[model samples]
Target: MKIDMSNLKFGAVEKPEKIGNEYFAVVPYFFTLKCNVSSMNDDMKKKIGAAVIQKYGKNNVQYLAAEGAYLINARMRACAISPDRKTWKFVILEKEYKSQLVKVLPKKILDKI
Candidate 1:
């Protein structure tokens, strides 16, 4: 499946940084973006969640309320988290690399995938 990055809307996105195999040997392509915001509030989460649902379809997006994250298509993973009060890190791992990393994922996350 091809993910059209342009279709997904976001707020205050900074230039994305390409992630390499040093982080995870299995996934050949990975990248992360920083979404700068004033605070990590419910509204921000709601907006990002909405954008994800809009881009991937509600049926393919699963919201993990406990983790405050969204898992897409059971193969592709997308989640935004606040590392600090002013920055939200948005990480997206392409689905094409999932098969190689399946065995390394925790059981909890693997079950959802």
Candidate 2:
């Protein structure tokens, strides 16, 4: 998804944090994408789930407790895609910490994987 940076409305973040290189802005839960994760096809869900599991993990309980994500919730940070995998950047919520740039596998590619 293409996130409009200018239109983003942050929730309770007092200030943005610089984790390493990228810059992230905190936002409220209200701004999260409204879509049914289960509504997606098995392959698509599997792809996204795999990406999530790879980045996060397959253990739902462990993922939730360790990653600060709730069970059954797919948390997504606004990211900018680039041809070079090293350029992918995302903004984390809460502290608005900018995570390290990593490859963001597209949903289509994830299905094929």
Candidate 3:
């Protein structure tokens, strides 16, 4: 999904905080995905996983379906937008953040990744 950025809307956010090299801002994920995670095939999943790792760096990226969500729900301050992973969303705390995180990245970026 080539996100227009402008079409996307963000929910309320807490005050921003600086963690490591990035500033963190907490916001809610409003189930805005072109497709659902449960239906994606392995190849597709791998493709998305790799693209995410590339943009966010393997060490800095994560996928929180259920368990992962629980783990990050308390302390994570950084999140990748559903599609390209080019945009990073920061949240102050985990309890309030939410997203389906399933957006199609640009074809050019996908080829490079």
Instruction: Compose the digit string of candidate 1's lDDT tens values, residues 11-81.
Output: 34323332321121121222222233324578886887787677667876765676555566532344333
Candidate 2 error regions (>4 Å)? 1-35, 61-113
**Highest lDDT: which candidate?**
1
Pick by TM-score: which candidate is best? Answer: 1
| Total colliding residue pairs, candidate 3 | 7
Q: What is the lDDT of residue 32 in candidate 1?
A: 29
- Candidate 3 off by > 4 Å: 1-36, 65-113
Better of 1 and 3 by TM-score: 1
Rank list by lDDT: 1, 3, 2
Question: Can you give the TM-score per candidate against the true fold?
Answer: 0.32, 0.26, 0.27
TM-score of 2: 0.26
Candidate-wise lDDT, in order: 0.45, 0.37, 0.38
Instruction: Please give the range of 10 consecutive residues that has the lowest summed lDDT in model 2.
Output: 93-102
Per-residue C-alpha lDDT of model 2 across residues 1-113, encoded as one tens digit per residue: 11111223434632343334443333333222222344455566556556656653465312222332323333434433333434544433222232222233333322322
Q: Whole-model lDDT, candidate 3?
A: 0.38
